[model samples]
Target: MWDRLATDGLAILVIMCLIELIVPSRAKGPVMWGFNLVFSLMLFASTLYYAHFGSVPTYTALRELHQVPQIKGSVESLIEPEYFLFFIDLLVLAILWGVTLSKPKSMRLGRRPVWKIGVAAAGVVSLILSGWYIHNGGKIENEIVQAENLGFLDYQVAAVLKENRQNDEITDGNLGKTKSEVKKLQATFAYKDASSGKGNLQYFGAAKGKNLIIIQMEAFQNFPLHLSLNGQELTPVLNKLAAEGLYFPNFYQQIGQGNTSDAEFMSNTSIYPTGTIAMSTGYGDRELPSLPRLLEKYNYESSTFHVNDVSFWDRSKMYPALNFTHYYDKPSYTNDHFNAFGASDEELYRVGVEKLSELHKQNKPFYAQFVTASSHAPFNVPKDRQRITLPDSLQGTELGDYLTAINYTDYAIGTLVERLKQNGMWDDTALVAYGDHFGILPKLASEEFISSELGIKYNDQVSRYNIPLLIHIPGQSSGKVVERVGGQLDILPTVANIMGVSLAKEGFTAFGHDLLNVDHNIFGMRYYLPTGSFFNDDVLFVPGKGFDDGTAISLKTYEPVTDITKYRADYDYILKLMKLSDAYVKQLPKRGP
Candidate 1:
């Protein structure tokens, strides 16, 4: 309890000092008290955030406060009665101040600079202690563990320091050297058999000259594709698509602070998000090597469609950085009041299909991306939009709302397919659909609750991060379910292979491999999970202090695995790979202003 108080109270104390410095000496007492009360309330808010995200928010997360207004329903639902206790001191101080106001002016104590000196001194001491704690903590790999060791204030300080160090490392590094290191590391891994006479480039250029359409679904998970709720299919359209395409059941999300946008970055560039900040916000000025640039060589026009404002998550800079030829944002679609994003997935697809069809009519091959937002958080669907009926037990619950939203999203895809078919583009298009990240917050959606309700076992982190990846090639009618473990980082190479684009030949550096050809795969994730954590074919391993003290859980069984000795190679490999990815991305030339 004392540790909790010390760690949580630091923010409150810092706020108090700031108030002391700003307010008049005469009003310091009541003002400080009121400010401390507000700080306490913020602490409660942070706790709620931690409970939902399984990590503490740093200073960078504060930049997203402007987004709260858009997600007010979800934000409000996180508040609980216990958070009100933070206001108790404010209530007492208010009464005391009222009573003192009634007393004579002579009865009040005179202001002293000594009190200010003491507060300033305490603040300095707090800073010193925080720095000491962070220094002793060693590496800033796992943010949750770092925060636990150094407290929130110190963790924020450590984050800033670590980010600075990373920037310096990137600025000093050579891209050529990083690429060589990547090549050597990849060569060591036996991705394919050379001695057996099987070419490493199997299925390379399988569907050349095909128009590409990628749908990055928001907060969609793989579990819904195969699961039924109350005898009703949750994602019927996705299920049908899975039946007609290449389905990767073991695919995971590799997003960092950027979330959906990070997924976009990885899927396009196969590079790792720095994990300290949103990739879109941090590296959007870099001349990124991406699919759009690669496709442009083949005379393919690249465009992306999203219902949100182009500036959200700084995508305005990101799209240009990725070298997309065109983009359709909020102004391109009709307002359907679907959610905070304003337009429904159906409308987004309508605009996308029409635009792509126009490009096809001009005899131009296009690479079009559709970012779906109808199934975004709070999972609220308009009455007319909802296509699924929930059982009485889940009527107003988050689970029920999620299913309804997902069902509507699935229904919308059918409309997109119909439009594509009507435009005579269905037979020649190569379609890929995958989720940006996980949706369910573990605090509200417990493992037992999900297992019992959905009749399927769910591991908090493993299953939560697991998302669907379905790629439908033109002229293919039968589906293939590949059991290889993969992440968003693998999407580029995988799609490139099917589209007959050779990354190696183009001198493109990708941190991920082709999920279609690779027999075994491993990917690292550092956003919701710790930096050292990695998922292989067997288990998800998370480090404690270091790899020696780490823990592993079986992906298939969702149970704890005691012996993690076999996964040491994967841990080391993934760490090296992610470091190389960071270096490679940072070394890229900055885009012109």
Candidate 2:
């Protein structure tokens, strides 16, 4: 809780400082100091409470802050001071400082209209922003409250601690401690890295000499598969490859830490997801045993390719932790420029091809991991492709732009496939492509776009988590569609299966199953924010935590199963997964049995 308050306070203070710089204020110092002192005191008090009483009261306070607004249909219902007051306090202090610093008697409202206008504009902006901050904080608090009622607070608290711990100084002891935690974290999952079992590269088929390529496509969604009057087929290349590849149609992703590198860590290392900031931001310095190191035992070269800022998510250190021999980020690419997210997909694919060809020429099989960035928010694609126009339904909205970006990325994939075929590298190489997670369609947009597109009310928990996964094995004409639901965690075992490696028996007992195997039964838990969904063979549970003490009823059946304890157990699993995910990414090895 202090971490949250501290982070928020730091951000607010930074913003206030920046504002002061832009509009020099002499009189505001006293008010700013007073405001800071008050906030500091409040923060200290809260920290004391958290340490003494535990997170229970803090959690309770948070829950109470989210209660349905007393006044119906009031935006005030959305405002929660506890959450947003930290920022408000900063803004208020800054304003008070500015006002106090100003020589009011000498100040002329008309004499210096420019400064007055600037100050007024800044004040308005601050007030609007403060309002929004409060609203979102309240809204999120409500969601947290609901989740807590359903027993997710423990996981939430665990997530808070795990995230904070990662930012601590990276010491050998810390790394060693991380290594110990990995065992408990991985225990929550079923399968172990096959390489962990025998310490023999041959058992995991790393000796088979098959090249591996894992691609994490940003903001890829399943809606594009449905051809509409205005919606262009977004992934023709992947759809075409689906005919020749082993397609896992029912695969899901258990995304953690809302960052691409974190997704890569989870997918590659079979770690669970964390509920906090991007794992890369927090765990970049920790040492851990990752897939790259495990595969290095078989003499395979490993590399990571991200056509974006190398420092965006602290990828500089993370790639090394994963034991990649090389990392090719924006600096390495001198071709086309990137827009909103980063480099154009065309450029990314072209650069990736050149890199792959170079590695192939060396006669050393390599793991070339490429992360796509074009399909991210703002949906900036090259202007050359025909712009995709959505129906009246999505026109002028972010969804329309998002789909257009998807189509652009699909074309880039097509180009990549053609290049591989032309170079004769298509036959022996393997292609694994999966979306990082669902695109961010704001609530209004989700209702207008996703709900309309699917012809189903998108209110339930399960609808948002659906994504696409495609695995293409060169020259292996599987042409098989497997409907068994799986997630990124299952990818390791599935790859091991294809590469002909055996997963550790005890490891498979936790979370992942071999995708190619029919007897495996697995469950998945997914979250986007406060709301979340859990899926198993039996049923897909959409749990609203705060409503009626958490488990309200099946949105589909309206049958009540409000067992707070059950919800708590599920949340504990989520918490466990979050820790495991980070520990794995930091390449910290679990204590072996």
Name the top TM-score candidate.
1
RMSD to native, candidate 2: 12.1
Q: After superposing candidate 2, which stretches have Cα over 4 Å from the reference?
A: 1-143, 146-208, 226-232, 453-460, 505-511, 518-527, 530-533, 538-548, 552-593
In terms of lDDT, model 1 sits at 0.84
Tens digits of per-residue lDDT for model 2 on 231-270? 3565677887777776765565577433466678776666
Candidates in order: C-alpha RMSD to true structure = 2.9, 12.1
lDDT of each: 0.84, 0.57
TM-score of each model, paired residue for residue? 0.91, 0.65
lDDT per residue (tens digit) for residues 405-457 in model 1: 88888888889989999999998898899999988887777878877888887
